[model samples]
Target chain A: MRVVLPAGTTETALIDGISAAGASPELMAHTPSADAEILEYGEPTTAPLTPVSPSGCPTPAAITRAVREVVGFDVTVVDAGLTEPTGAATVDLDIDPGTDVRTPTAVPDADAIYDRAHGFGASLPEDDLLIGETVPGGTTTALGVLTALGEPATVSSSLPENPVERKRRVVDEGLAASDLEAGDCDGAPMEAVRAVGDPVQPTVAGITAGALESGAEVTLAGGTQMVAVAALLRHAGVDAALSIATTSFVADAAGDLETTCERLDCELTVTDPGFDRRDHTAMERYCAGEAKEGVAMGGTLSLVPDGKMAALRDRVETVCSRLGIDADGSPKEETGSNTTE
Target chain B: MRVVLPAGTTETALIDGISAAGASPELMAHTPSADAEILEYGEPTTAPLTPVSPSGCPTPAAITRAVREVVGFDVTVVDAGLTEPTGAATVDLDIDPGTDVRTPTAVPDADAIYDRAHGFGASLPEDDLLIGETVPGGTTTALGVLTALGEPATVSSSLPENPVERKRRVVDEGLAASDLEAGDCDGAPMEAVRAVGDPVQPTVAGITAGALESGAEVTLAGGTQMVAVAALLRHAGVDAALSIATTSFVADAAGDLETTCERLDCELTVTDPGFDRRDHTAMERYCAGEAKEGVAMGGTLSLVPDGKMAALRDRVETVCSRLGIDADGSPKEETGSNTTE
Candidate 1:
């Protein structure tokens, strides 16, 4: 079965890891300027899409294109949308779909999107699965997901001086935005996703559950965002095995790796480490968090096998060679679509 | 110790396995034109050095520069000056150094020049080892070296098809021109080096042996040429541990791997597997005996503490990254000097 990853730049590493393991995957890129926020922070604040050149389509459109590229097979596109904060606020929060979203008093439309995306009908394809995600400020979102589920989640950037205070503030703000009470949410993974989770987490959870029911293997083609999604899946009682494809740089980063793996309960695999070696400072700035940390943490718990590292390295090298770019570390003249939308 | 590798178009992958393990290495170009003659049915002729827009230095000079750049230590450059075919007349053979009027026999004098560059005395600062070589169809000289020692050494180009008949004829002709009988020679590895080996190979072996005697760590940096030099060292009973730094491409290639390894009884460490991956076809060429096999067959074994398969893969990725290259089954762009003299 083929899996598709609608990836951002660093996210490409995860897709490479998956593809290296003999799984067919299509990489659909969102235009560099597409400002679909996957994480929400502080008070409910609405941040409009930045008016920059939309280098590509939104995540939904990319998903559609991916489904089309893999012909002659049943396709399943998991909707992993996320909501941005409506206003400037200081706490972190997330929401689970089935329980919190299902309640009559909750945000009805917000919950409805989750139902539509997560509720798999009998008419959908049986063998294919598109594992995806949406986690806003995911390292913080991961913090929330872990805390609400009663794990001691210490989310910090992978920089030399691990910044725990900033992560704590984001997590606290996220918890405030989420509706589920801490006591009620304790020990329930889905409840955590529902309270502080963004749209992508629940959507991926539903997709994994649906795929498991249909007896298809699932390849989670994302970084930390998928980690949050996997947490939701476990909370929802999905018992399917998961394989994660990601870059080696992330896999090698220091973090609460063992905890993340135990929570996800899946194997993790990494592909090329070169991607993590790229300069992502701008990306980290815009994301309001370190991109490397998220990428690395996301790769930790995912199911990735060994041996494909060399193959993936070769593939990246092949592509770079074609572009007349040097592969060993020298900066090249920028020519491709600028990713710094 | 630092090690520098000249970046040749598509040959970086040839030695990546050894470079990644924190070995100090840099890639530079030797010549502007990438010219190497294709050995076919006739005895292969050496292609003229792609005329340097500026004048080109001799092979020994190029080796000297590489050693200085990579190792950052004093260097003893050995020049193995063998111009005349010591045995019989065969096909019109044109190895690069053979075409130059400076002749391979002038290498000892060249060594004196290198010694002068470093200021030698009765008790000089531990002489940076002598790393030597000769270019342009030097494998034929390797055969001559073996023949002069009374060993039935079979040599072919590292090209895809076996150039056995061509190589045999070249060896016969070169041997016929010399006064040394198959068995009537001094056993010093330098004897073969001075008689027939190229300037680079013998010089490097001499430097390596010299360093070992002085109780310094030594590395032979190059391809099949280094392997031949190592074999000579073993024959001389030098006890210093030796390390060979080369691309993985040469190691996986066929030919005198066993004999080279057995002769040296030392380890070979590859810089990057990507190097081997790209040059597989070329490696196959050498394996098929279409060309004479180059150095570092047991090179991996020489890596201190040895590298696991994973370490090898990591090293490949690291080298490729440093070169600003990737591993996608294609030839990378030449970054530095071209060795096609």
Candidate 2:
């Protein structure tokens, strides 16, 4: 099995209190690069540190890294439109980082990115491919894309309390800026991405489409963001049997995920990852609805055999120790629950 | 099976009458990118035209493309150090194009390129890998790398006459400029490349080492250029059994390839692709020793079933027809042969 993570960025993430992918809005630009580095090298080398929320929740890349250690799967990071360069080895799609969705032309070259990524996906030799994303403010872009495609989509957030209204307001502004109403891009999926979505959506959808065409079983390894991708595929007339895998945290937080999957005729697999039972602070954060799923944590966990759960926990412990974090992902010198609640 | 073609460039290709990879020396910088474009899209998109020798011998990328159409193998072009951007989707290693061998710092970051390529190679899920090259003036650089590592290598050429003494003179000047003896970098494979080699050498060797470490069966998939990569792997302390596959034209031109493989305890497979019997002018050029091998033509042909030879021939005819070439690869309106001899 091969796991491909498409890393990008969107200026929508800079909205105050909108994203928790990094410790602050300024640091959010480094989240994708940091996550990719951690996934490939067991720690971040390019960025100064790993991605952590202001409330001390570690990014879900740590969980995916642990699963890879236990399951021995291969990971490849694709630079769809990263704001920072990652120390990890990556496949570059030569895309520019997306502007804020309200700018109207967030991802102007979405179609070209899709076509090139489709060619790349057709070249993979793996029989099974799992795709994930790490785009800050991706959920807003997802909401924007889904609304443009005439779907009412409720997306999950990395913070403890999902900021549903803020996301909807941003999408509305984006729709107004692009001179588009709901369903304006209903049958033109790439147009929706061009107008409002981040670069990750077209890239992931392109890879999935090409992999499916090449007779490979592909799983969209993400949360409601992947639901948006599935909706795009359906609107594009790709009538394939597709599936998505993600954490129960995302599935629970975004109540529309199941109905959206069903409407798109896609299967959904939700795994708990047993983070609630772990003693690690980062793991505890997941149970609290912070840093719930990114970097394919749920999909990677799904691949781990029941017998390897203990091993996976051990690996996670090792990764956390390297980060010098405790239950709240704070430095050992200041260990305490740092949840916003 | 996967075929990885690493493309790069060197100022040595700009020396008067040194390279036949392009129609003229000024065009040599575009050869690597053009070859990659042709291999991926069945034609050149970024480049104004496909690569052709000064004498009008078409590049072997056409052959590789036809073989792919017949056998259905996956191909990936790795941008080791391309001067031009290819329209083809590629994996970029963030390397600079190599300087002339006469410059002591020919490939300044050879080790870093090697390490990164090794990581990329280890992530591949394929069990069988075929590695090729598309560097103009690569055979001369192969001689440079081999000599630096204490090997006497006789490399092949795209021109009919072989130009053996000219290549030797260039390497001699390079050795003198670097202030080193033939065996100065014997125990340091990457050092050999950094001193007087092209970026493609270290990149290919690093990928091969990483792929071998990951327990994949690998075949160096070009002519004497691949022989240089095998030599680097051996000097780097990789003792695993390896193999190389190429065409008989290269074996005949490079009479020492068999002995060098024997010295390195490696297996060699040389196949005759039956190009001599084909009526296409581009196919005839191989018989006359104009464009013997590049872009993994020999390795790809080795994968075809004996029964598929006719289909392969027909496909090659189709590719040649698309290029507007006749018996000597000249324009159909002017069908005179362009052979130097």
Candidate 3:
């Protein structure tokens, strides 16, 4: 399965406690390649920890690298809208770019984005794609779309604990600023996402749905944010051979992801990489629920068996060690293993 | 044959008589799809004539359309660097992107571009590929690359009449600005292209070379600019059973293309899409030495039969007529044929 990470940024990420997708938005905007940032590329050495989820345990960048190492699948990062270039050989899909969801027209070209992205996804010329994403504060837009679609849904967070009220307030604020009313998106998903969702939701949704129309099965490979995409598919009255895969963290989180998938009409699969046994204290964060899920950490992990979890853990450790990042995701004494070093 | 159009702009194209690729530099910056401005994408329909080549005759855009209509193949446009988006599904490859070639460090990441582009080309997953490009001032960069490689070559221009003296001045100025001296690129084609060429040269060179390395039959499908790519492959000691396919205009042009190919060690295939018999006055201009070549018009036209030239002519006329463009490519009365209209 191809790992597709549709990424973006919203000011919602800046609101304290809203997201842990990255150490900070600034860091998220520039992770080089997962392997590059961790192993090669960049320096005078900035961000010793690279970018990690709020939970010190598992970083999306680490897990993404594990997917590349363990599952050995093709990986593609789509810049739906980003603060800066992610130093990777990315497919540029900023046709509509992206914007702050706090405004009424968060994605003014929602329709065009859908069209072009549909073309983009449909044109992938690949088979059995596993589409994932990592946009900071993406869940805020997810909740906004879910609320507007009248889905009675709550999404998981990168925070160890889900921030229901804060997320709700952000959604509420976004809704207040938006022209959408409850159930307005019942038949208008693009408009719903346009008004309040981040750029990646509709883009991934379109790609998934469009590729499905082209008769390819796709895994909406992220957390509850994927619920927004499924909701878009469900509302658009299009049926896709789609399944939802995420981390066991989200599977075990407080969000109503399973029921959300049922109504949205998609399968839900979860994989826990069993980070608890790792020597690093940060690996135990999943057990504590600090960084539940982000990236396609869960879905990508699902491609491998429970047996490969050890390999995944080792991959992360190797990358972190090489980058001088401790298991807890902080700078440590220079390892001198890095090329520039 | 997949049409690949790698595009960028050089300030060299800004000098009067330097390039007629577009009507004016401003108009040149946004040529909807092909190398010429088009009537299809923009609204309130600007540039009634859409920017054509210096000649009042046929456009490479028309030839590309001819290829699409007659040959029917997948087309991919790579944005090596451009002033603005081309209003098409394009691939973006600007690590530093690219600036005017007049600067010493025009393409800062030449090696990376080559590597990434080679990866891109090698990863095509397709068996056969045809890559074309449409940088307005690509030929000037081509000339620079050729000169730097110690090849006494003169490339054809989009302008009906080759801007030899003007292009020579730009190439000399660019060479002077570039740190590379003549023959310095014998084993460093990318460095030469980087120092004196546009983003497209090394990029397509890398793509073509990488695709060939994958044991796939590839066609370097443009005119003189493609020579720069062939040079890159030759100098790199990389061997590929690569062939060149272009239009009669470039084939019959006064340039030493034939001798260049002989010394460069590549088979040259030229197709003469009989533009002389076409009733379209604009197309007849090809007979008059205007708009000689551009886009992948010639190479794409090569994919079909010589007899299809009439059909290709008809396709352009139909597209132009539907877009409210007259046979000469100027705007006629609004046809209400425009989707936006």
Predicted model with the maximum lDDT: 2
DockQ of each: 0.01, 0.08, 0.04
lDDT (Cα, tens digit) per residue for candidate 3, span A1-341:
55666766666666666764434445544432232232212221223335544334435556666556666664555667756543343456664445666677878888877876786567554568888776667778888888888888677766654677987887777777886577777788888888888787877887787778777789988878887888888888887557988877777875577877887778999787877777675567567766566667677778887677788788777755644567755655332211100
Q: For model 3, how does the per-residue alpha-carbon lDDT over B183-270 read when each residue is reduced to its tens digit? A: 7677777778777877777778878877788766888887788877888788878776777888787777745778888777878888
Residue-level lDDT tens digits of model 1 in A1-341 = 43322112212112222111221211112221122221111000123232111121112222222222222121222223322222111111123222222222222233444454443321133354545432223444555566666655554332323444655554455566665444456546555665554344444555466556766666665545556566666666666787655433344453555457666787665543333433332222222222233311233223222444333334434433322234443324332221110
Off by over 4 Å in 3: A1-144, A148-198, A201-341, B32-49, B53-58, B95-103, B179-184, B332-341
Candidate lDDT values, in order: 0.36, 0.80, 0.65
Q: By descending TM-score, how would the candidates be arranged?
A: 2, 3, 1
Over the true interface, candidate 1 deviates by an RMSD, in Å, of 35.1
Q: Which one wins on TM-score?
A: 2
Order of the predicted models by lDDT, top scorer first: 2, 3, 1
Clashing pairs in 2: A281-A327, B281-B327
Q: Which wins on DockQ, candidate 2 or candidate 3?
A: 2
